[model samples]
Target: MIVAPYMLKAFLCSVGLTWMRSRSPGAGISRSWARALPCKPSPAGVAAVVGTAAVPPCCFLQQGQLSLRGGLRVPPCAFSTLGWWMVGIPPDTAGTSSVGLRAERSPVFACSPMDLSELLKEGTKESHDRAENTQFVKDFLKGRIKKELFKLATVALYFTYSALEEEMDHNKDNPLFAPLYFPVELHRREALAKDLKYFYGEDWKEKIQCSEATQQYVDRIHHVGQHEPELLVAHAYTRYMGDLSGGQVLKKVAQRALKLPSTEEGIQFYVFDNISNAQQFKQLYRARMNALDLDKNTKERIVEEANKAFRFNMQVFDELDKVGRSLGEEAQDGGVPVHDGKGDIRKCPYYADKLGTAGPSCPFHAAVGLARQPLVQLVLAACMAVAAGAAAWYIL
Candidate 1:
């Protein structure tokens, strides 16, 4: 029987995602199954079948042959055309490979069971989500940030990065952490100092003191750098990669929210002068991290430490949230408003929460309520009636 092309594509994508997900820590897939599937199906090959580009590299169709790990090969035409070549292979003839291809079992193309970058990403995903959803981060994203709170947040970052960079400097030469060190590209302490100077003037150093939460985070960084130097990789990866990922977006939000100057003064901490291409630099950094000489246990510990770093950040955010509550100042106005392109005001989380509340905060709801008033309704109805009568007279 001929298998439909879409069916074959779906099967391949399912296999690809399964292999990719199984590589994460605590994935329930059996070790033998993971070894059998090998590297994720290459995006090009999967895209050729599925019409979307995603998934990491490994099995791919080259020239005319589809090459997968474990020495399994199939012609591109097998799935491209409607044929039984793919589906007709007997189960008994299929060897170690799961896709019914004869397994030749070569060791040359074998991939490591885990990469440090993927491990940290998957393991700390929950912690990252919690940190992002915290009230401070959510408010900042919505441009509801007060200038005072923003400056205090900058102060916290200055202290955190100062400690992190100091530790990174001491471990820069060590074999365990050396590959990941990129002072010019990734360090933010100097940039943060510039931001503080802009916000608090030349006496910024004396005006800003580390908050209790921030001090705890700094102490942890120092402790990790001094005693468990190898685990410093966790803090570096967590902070620098996260900053690189979200820095520009946050910078734009802060600039608009606080009405900061266009010269990039107060938001200097988010600007990476040395790194021209953040994406390529991040890929290079992850590659270097994967190349490190580390065992499974060490890698697990590093993932745990990265989660700890995320926790420390969340604690700092909580402290900022508490401080924001006590301040009498209103959140800055004239900030850029968030739009989801649907134009429905209720869709915005910030506006949705304030929708029916009394005040000028929700003008849309106020207008809606006014339209429902008997006097306003009567006036609107009279206007519509007059316009209809005028149209009728014109037609006559």
Candidate 2:
């Protein structure tokens, strides 16, 4: 009769434990003995077999190695195998057997050094910081967003996603980009269209036009999709990952600040209905991106393209800020304030370094208002001049 490998290993382990208990007084099986069972071959291509009275040539005992007959010896195993099980404990000479084995767990799937997901994240961190600090983003986070600007922003997103999704669809069949093509779960064009309709009425198509900044972004996406399809992964990773990470926070801010209905109108762009677990979906997407068969140069190019995507987003934000300034609408006060109980302005998502420190109430806006004042500007300029003069004098 043939026995399975695991079954054979189990039987050997049971026999070995019984023999050890009978030969050595007070020798008990350690909890780790189960994991250390010789189920697979060691690194030297030798199977660690347990036998009675005599052991194979591969099994020998030195100082602290496992032994079956006279002395305990264990052959070297792969790092992966060592990660799975603990090393065998040496027998005690004082008539007592105590097992000391340390268990270490290793990653199930070993990742390559040049993982695409990790590369993109580290490369775009600076760009991400700059994007978050944009005046338009800060205002939106503070619930100071105007309705007209918000509608315009939605229009921009609609056009941008329209172009991106079209390109993604075109390249879905390509091997290099096929694995990352998640149409149903990651696509946002349809959702953004619904948001546009809610904001611009049924004739939303006629009323909304793509801003120049958004047009530039759309043009780049189309170019990438048509000419350099491999680079499409960068744009996809930037937009989709950002949306999944911060979409809910932005949605709540918009809904509260705009006084939109609780039924989730005007913010469908942020609502990912198809994605039940956004975090898990993001992890899956990252894994797919990392699994793509791209060389080092292509990975670097992708990272560069992701930074360009961030720049495009920043330009769109700047354009929106300009339009918002022209509208002369009062900032809405419906945004949820992020604080650390001490009313720390730094913790506020709206806080930017250029906007100066916080004030007693609504510090971000207060700093912005103060900076905009002619007197405050002149005072700041004078202080800067005085500091420069002091430094020059000291140098001289």
Candidate 3:
């Protein structure tokens, strides 16, 4: 029995995708997926925001309206049908796959990690571990004496960190000022005071100052290190899109599992609009992942590790998710007025979000609105004084 090959394997095994070590003789690892969901144009970039009635609409849902044009309904996954395939790195035994989109692997909450593959394969590290407990971290420490597992473990942990980092990076520079996706940006304007406080525990800003790697990532992407928490929140918003977006299917599923109403709105803040023809692209993505160069063992290890990463993510979320309930937010009605219970008028914004923050149409952010106008007045005053000085000198 192979106990473990790598620490990532152990972590992955702890979470479940460990069955990937063997190759089915006839099956190709590269499989086709559905299609890519259309990503809306970045608000500051080239992404096209779908109008309420845009015919060639790329993103299905827009503003506050779902696309009735294409009968845009939620599939098994709120992501486009091909979402799984797009995220799939290696195709499963099936010719077509729901690899990434669907929750294929079961989540495990383990305190300790172990890789059973090594025990069976090379059987090299049979010395230290004796009574590896299946439940807690202490038990796992008590069980194995595998020397090689530690090296593999480092890789697993590093890989997990990288994935988490990437997840955050993708959002930080998204060019879309839609904090409705991650509502805390309102707090970020005054981020120096509240950012580290609300998100990080304490002295968090100083902690970022020490991270050269973080600074490097930010510099590479044209952002500052302080932006990391923003990215983290952004990534978190994307990953737990169900909580953020009003994914009724996800809500129903979660509601049934956890015993709550799926329609419990004002609970999340995310935005992943349904893209068209999402089913066919996933297979294409699976091909892309498998195409990456690696030997069989390493490949399998990556797959297992990726799944393990998901589990690790779940653990992180387990700790952080509780904070979701305490979130102070609400769904916007695309900038329309609302009536209070007593029938008083409530103000809504057009491009400004729930935070009274602005985007595309915000006057507060405009140079002409926020600074340039005043700056021009000051410059004019200075220029007039200078002209008067010159005239007085000439007359004298």
Candidate 4:
């Protein structure tokens, strides 16, 4: 008879448990499972068979080793109960035994104890930190940036999220996305459009231009949507969750700094009218993700995609920083506020690379250029002498 590997493993487990019961007083075996029964002693050391349940026949047995039809290997009929702890196998299949079975073939649906949420957190930690530490975000929150810079950021975000949400909508029918897809509750297109109108006036459609970085990000999303739709989950998670959390904080900061009223026109992008409670909605989203039927490999791929999403966001920040640097001359010429009578531009490492020197708009560079001109130097010396004489006259 053809014996399934699982059945053979069950038979071996029952034999081992019955032997233990005979030797030990009131053995740990559940009475309802294996009732005591009499039988002739076998060379396998099984003194009795305790249950009437039918066990399939083994394909081959040699040298005290039992070989089953399926790909299973047991040397000396050895088994441990630990592997069954978190598995979904039936408890009564092996005469109420909990022993772990050995199989040459891997389990049908292998999973990690860590669910989707933990996987995302661990996988994207580095990328998340990099995104947060970007100079563009720091300056934006501090209110030391121009409104035009903020508008540029919003435009880039519009393009990125537009691509992502479009892919998600198209792939909503996919089995993997169906569970985690909450388009109505988490969608940002309408809100972003309202904010765009506020930023660029009614002609935002004609004025808005996507940065190169944003184009690259959108292209990646499109590629993934066509070739690997499952990856869109990671991008959705990265953008939506961030918009709910840090994005809200930025909204309040920008409103206060830019003196924008708390209206849809100014801050609609951060407003989630559909989702009243961000934390509760986030928990529900995570629960859906946790309940997804994904294998270990698929989960790993999603995690990698999430890290890529963060990298894309950081690239947008870099592009925004470049845009901000282009406005340095304007900022120095009273287009934006000056920090203590000088350019209010931040001289962080990111901007330092763009400007080629430190300290806002590089006042030192202007001084050096003026010093190179002999006429400018002679005029400066004459002014200093006149100022010195005026100071002496006033003192006298």
Candidate 5:
């Protein structure tokens, strides 16, 4: 049967994903256990040994050949990237060695256990703190931002979590997702929906719109779900973990700043109803992540994807900051641009000094003159305080 490239890619990716998940911690069998089983070289030499009979035609056409783990002499095209992520392809000299092709076992998987959760925490600590200390974020934390701006931030989050949760549900049956699929425990879509109603009122769905940054973030989650669903693991780790950790702090800040009632009305998005102990739950979540049957390359890719997820969030913050700034400006007034095309969040005087970059010039003088107005002065003071605090935050 003829298949389009996208479909073929998706099919292969799914197969690979399934194959890898089948070896996860709770999955019936594991690689170490399977290695002890008896096996025979294929009659067709290396090709037959690798289960070439059940292999699809696309595998042969797209890739050269499949090499058995033992010493089977097959073509170079043992697996495509999709399959590569699924079933590991033997090295080039796999079968040529006197000992046949042996699956490359990761030290973390076999010998030294690695705490993926701790690694993520340590790897992302700086960026995570920086994001929290951004001028826009500090304004919200200090309750200095307007209710409308705060609502807008929630709106953006609504779009993002919607995409992520929907994709997770769609791919839940996949083995790679089985261990991590805690819809009751980690799902935030319904909570975010409640927040949207509280902020935008009953007609929230009709009125809410995504910013360009929010849309980009949504598109990225969808793209990964469609093409490389395995990477969703990383996205989940980046977002949900952050939500469970720093999100708790932000929840308290928001409730106080927004004067939200001590109920689920406004802060529903941050509440974890099923999880009584956030720290304990986080440990469980990390255990599932570390238990995933990912090879070294796949693990590396997951880490990279997590980093990308953080960068995506920073971009969303940048977009939100622009919207907040635009709230006070005159029709033709152009405020100082903060972000460059690159994803650097600390590009302005406030953040630049924090990052040790020379501060930008005084283009905001014209804008500051308008701040002399009564109502504008209050906001300007808050902005200046937020900026100075954010800059100093990096120093200390």
Candidate 6:
């Protein structure tokens, strides 16, 4: 029963986390927070509904609740600063969500490097000062990694540290860019202003719409998408490049995820042969962009759109948070559907009689089918591309 000092510290920390979550008394909502690229003004009632909130990742640990869709509770934990990526799974109801109290503690089994985040936290001001120092940045990168051998260590550092100067200070990559110069201040919603009328039947404030500047950001992004095609292809490449074979790395990720990585990852599903001459294919992609002849302003516009994708995503979560919170409150009242947990798969014939369900045109099924089409086509196209490349290689 006698605990050591360190053990005592940890025990108290866990106790402390529980205490923090339970702080807001009166029937805790089963809320799930999301980890995202960076902060954005949430859609009104996000945090209030589930009583769950998503905070940006920091170097030190964080304490909060995160919910996957459909209610899988994510206990807070120490995670990497996405450097700016949202850890975002866009707003799809298909993902899981959970609600409960949990510690923002690091897992024991994960083989992680020393608390580099903690180290960086201590040096945040200093590192930002040296934001332009390539040598210091390289040293910082080398110091933060773990590898079995030096050669492999170099490779990890090579990939991880590729972008430094720009990330630290450039407007394009900095997490704080959206807050500055957009005219409106950073959105920090009040706890109760969440009950908007649409999601909650209460008389809500006129929805605080995205500011005009934000709209400009959105318009610029879409405009670029149509006029400058590189962003689309670049985004596609960025989306598909990982775990090409569903190799060991994915298998590892799959293990940690209660749902294992499985074969669904990477380009294994990709029919494209590994590009031996990546330059040539890149040249082809570049040619496509060049042919577009998108003006420089237009090209930048597309990149801006790429940026808005993230901003818009957070906006949705913000709104969903309101809806989700209201629903959680409703569930607390009487929203739990009493079935064998089997949904009325079809609309309740009763509500349907009154409001006419989209019946045969169950939009959900249609959307699901439509979503799968592009993916199937992409795979087949990649396969065809791979086969043609192989054939050409053999002919040569």
Which of the two, 1 or 3, has more lDDT?
A: 1
Task: Report backbone clashes per prediction.
Answer: 0, 5, 46, 1, 6, 32
- Tens digit of lDDT per residue, candidate 2, span 88-196? 2222222212222121221112233477887886788788778778989877766788998899999999999999999999987786787677776678988888888
Candidate 3 vs candidate 6: the lDDT winner is 6
Tens-digit lDDT track for model 1 on 1-396? 133444445445544554555443223233234345424344454322111112123342222343333342322211111111212223234332332223222111222448787788678767766776788877776677888999999999999999999998998777688756667667898899999999899999999898999999999999999999989999888777766666555676678778889899999887877655454355445645665668899999999998898888889989999999898877475433432222223212111222222134346755875765545655565565555555556655
Model 3 has a clash total of 46
Ranking of all predicted structures according to lDDT, beginning with the best and ending with the worst? 2, 1, 4, 5, 6, 3
**Model 2 Cα shift for residue 301 (angstroms):** 0.3
- Residue pairs whose backbone atoms clash in candidate 1: none
Lowest lDDT 10-mer window, candidate 3? 343-352
lDDT of each structure?
Answer: 0.63, 0.63, 0.27, 0.57, 0.57, 0.27
* Candidate 5 similarity to native, TM-score: 0.54
lDDT of 6: 0.27
Please say which candidate is ahead in TM-score: 5 or 6: 5
lDDT of 1: 0.63
* 293-381: candidate 6 lDDT, tens digit per residue: 23455445444443343333234323333333343221111111111211221111100111122122245654555544534445444
Give the deviation of candidate 1 from the true structure as CA RMSD.
Answer: 16.5
Task: After superposing candidate 1 on the true structure, give the runs of residues whose Cα lies further than 4 Å from its correct spot.
Answer: 1-113, 334-396
Which prediction has more favorable lDDT, 4 or 5?
A: 4
| Model 2 weakest lDDT span, ten residues long | 100-109
TM-score of each: 0.60, 0.60, 0.22, 0.55, 0.54, 0.20
Q: Cα RMSDs of all predictions? A: 16.5, 22.6, 30.3, 26.7, 22.9, 29.1
lDDT of 3 by residue, 54-151 (tens): 11212221221221112321112112222123222243422212322322321111110121222111221111121111122221112211222222
